[model samples]
Target: MGEADRIITLPAKLATALHGIAPGLITDTLAFANRFLPDPGGIGEQQMDGKNSETYLSNSLLARLTDEAAEANNEIG
Candidate 1:
C-alpha cells in the first residue's frame, strides 16, 4: 500500500485488533477518520470543528501521528 493508504488505514486496523484482543475496549472515536477525511492531503489544517472534546482531541492526535508517519515514510521511501 501507498503512504496515504497506510496513514488512513492504520488506525482502524489497530482499533480492530485491540477490540479483538479485548472486546468492547475500543470506541468508535478511535476509528474516526480512518475510512475518510474531509481533507486527506491537508489533514493537519482540516477543521475538526463541531466534534466533542474527546473526539476532537483523539482525532487531533491521530492527525499529528499520521502526518509524522507520512513524513517518515516519504523520507525513507
Candidate 2:
C-alpha cells in the first residue's frame, strides 16, 4: 500500500498528524487513492488525473485539519 493508502486506512488522529506533516510530499507521492480508498459519498468515482489528484488530496487534507481544529475549539470552548 502507498502512503496515501496508509493515510486513508489509518485512524483519524494518526492520519491527521501524518497528513498535517509533509502534505506536499504526500501530494507528490499520491497515485490516486480512489483505487483503494473508495469515498462512501461516491466522490471517488470520477477519474483523478495528476493535477486533479493533487488538488483533491490537498483539499481533503485541509478539510481534515479544519475538522480537527473545530473539534479542538469545541473542546476548549
Candidate 3:
C-alpha cells in the first residue's frame, strides 16, 4: 500500500493519555519560550534587528535546516 493509504491505529488508552497531557505540555513549552526567547518573532526578525553574528548564523542554519526538512518531507510524502 502507498504511504498515503496506510492507516495505523493507536490504543484508546494511550490516545486518551496523550490528549490529557498535550495541552499542559504545550503550554509549559510555550511558557519556557516566553521566558527565555522573549520579544522576537523568529530568526528573521532577530537577524533583521541586527542582533549579532550568532543570530545571523543561527538564521542561516535554520533556513538551511528548513529547506533540507522540506526536501526530505517531499521525498517521503
Candidate 4:
C-alpha cells in the first residue's frame, strides 16, 4: 500500500499525530480520487499530477530534525 493507504489504516493516535487525518477521511479521499466521476474539487487532479500541496508543511531543517527525532525515539525506546 502507498502512503495514503498506510495513513488511512493507521490507528487513531498516530492519525491524529499525522495532522488529524482521521482514518475514515483518508480512506474516503482515496476512494474519491479513484472513482469514475469528475472530482468535486481539484484533489484528484493534484493527486494525479503529484504536485506539492499549497499548504507548505515545514522548512527542510525542521522536517529533517523531526525525522531524526522520530528515528531516535524509535531506536531508543
Candidate 5:
C-alpha cells in the first residue's frame, strides 16, 4: 500500500493524530481511493493512480520519516 493507504488504514488514535496535524488529509485520501465503487466498470469510478501517488510519496520526507518510525516501532515490538 502507498503512504496514503497506510495512513487511511491507521488506528483511530493515529488517524486522530494525523487529523490534528493536517486537517482534511484523510478525507482527501479517501476521496481518491477506489474502493466501494458501485460501478466497478469504466463508469464514473474515480481511482487514485497508484504510480503517481507512489512517485510523489517516494519523494516525500514525511513519508520516509513515518516509514522509519514504523519500522523502528516494529523492531521494538
Candidate 6:
C-alpha cells in the first residue's frame, strides 16, 4: 500500500509495535529538547507560551519519528 493508505489505515498495527517502545524514547526526547527553545514545527500550536510540556513532547516526538520513517521509506522506494 502507498504511504497515504498506511497512514490512514495502519495505526492499529503500528500502535501494537510502537506502544512499549515509546515511553523511554519520549522521556529522553523531551529531556533533550528542553535544553533550548522548542521548534515551531516540533509543536502543534504556534503560540506555544510554554505551559504545555507534555503536549509539546507528544506532538513533537510522534511527528519526528513519523517524518523520519516517511523520509526513509521514500528513499528506499
Top candidate on lDDT is 5
Top-down lDDT ranking: 5, 6, 2, 3, 1, 4
Q: Which consecutive 10 residues in model 6 have the weakest lDDT in total?
A: 49-58
Clashing pairs in 3: none
Tens digits of lDDT, candidate 1, 1-58: 7534554577777766677687644556545645575334334666664332234555
Question: Could you estimate the TM-score for every candidate?
Answer: 0.24, 0.25, 0.24, 0.23, 0.30, 0.23
lDDT of 1: 0.57
- Expressed as tens digits, the lDDT of each residue in 38-69 for candidate 4 is 43555743444322433234445646686587
Model 6 per-residue lDDT at 66 = 65
lDDT of 6 by residue, 1-77 (tens): 85445554476556545645696775676688787864556555656543234565556866688658768888423
Task: Locate the minimum summed-lDDT window of 10 residues in model 5.
Answer: 36-45
TM-score of 2: 0.25
What alpha-carbon RMSD in Å does predicted model 6 have with respect to the real structure?
13.6
lDDT of 3 by residue, 1-77 (tens): 75423435556455445656796875676688788764545465434533233445556865677658768888424
Which has the greatest TM-score? 5
- lDDT of candidate 4? 0.57
The superposed Cα distance between candidate 3 and the true structure at residue 71, in angstroms, equals 20
Candidate 6 CA-lDDT value: 0.60
lDDT of 5 at 46: 71
What is the alpha-carbon lDDT for the whole of candidate 2? Answer: 0.60
All candidates' lDDT scores? 0.57, 0.60, 0.58, 0.57, 0.64, 0.60
